[model samples]
Target: MTHRYLKNVVSLELDKDKCTGCGKCTEVCPHNVFIIENGLAEIIDRDRCMECGACANNCPFEAVTVEPGVGCAAAIIKGWLTGSEPSCDCSGGDSSSCC
Candidate 1:
């Protein structure tokens, strides 16, 4: 089954203008969040993204960018376990205080 996070919360972005249709994002994404269509990469399911930053790191043309471990998987899991609103603590504080 496909896993999806909170709607409209993921930070994944794709710059189609910079994409080279190299399919690197498609290959590196663990969640299958991207797909190549019409010779360009498209965000098929933004919520499916875990904000892992693998796609961005692998994109040779720097077409993708995502703030990894910010407010997606870790926050969702923490919310599920604590029965509270999802929070990533992205206050730009110490790294140990985040997520």
Candidate 2:
């Protein structure tokens, strides 16, 4: 009954190997998803992330990646109830019809 890859799993995964420690991802992230730990952007306060694609877009090194945005179960449920787009943006728009 669980929607795989359609659930709210907002967590920052830092690829330490790729992280150049540019600090760009940390700076633009409105949720403060990254931090400088040993000169690398460590995953800190991941729950605070809103998954707005800021981290992914801002990540110049392509080190950090996350399924950002709307981890709220209620919202996903509501979207389903109203035939709206699922939680993920794979549809390429804000509504289900766009999918």
User: Which candidate achieves the best TM-score against the true structure?
Assistant: 1
Highest lDDT against the true fold, candidate = 1
Q: For residues 1-99, what per-residue lDDT tens digits would candidate 1 score against the true structure?
A: 755557988888999999989999989998888889999999998888888789988889988999875446666776788898767653346565543
lDDT of 2 by residue, 28-94 (tens): 8876667888888787666666677787878877887877556567568768887985564545454
Candidate 1's TM-score reads 0.68
In candidate 1, how many Å is residue 16 off?
0.5
Whole-model lDDT, model 1? 0.82
Give lDDT per model, in order: 0.82, 0.71
RMSD of each: 7.1, 8.1
Which residue pairs collide, candidate 1?
none
Score every model by TM-score: 0.68, 0.60
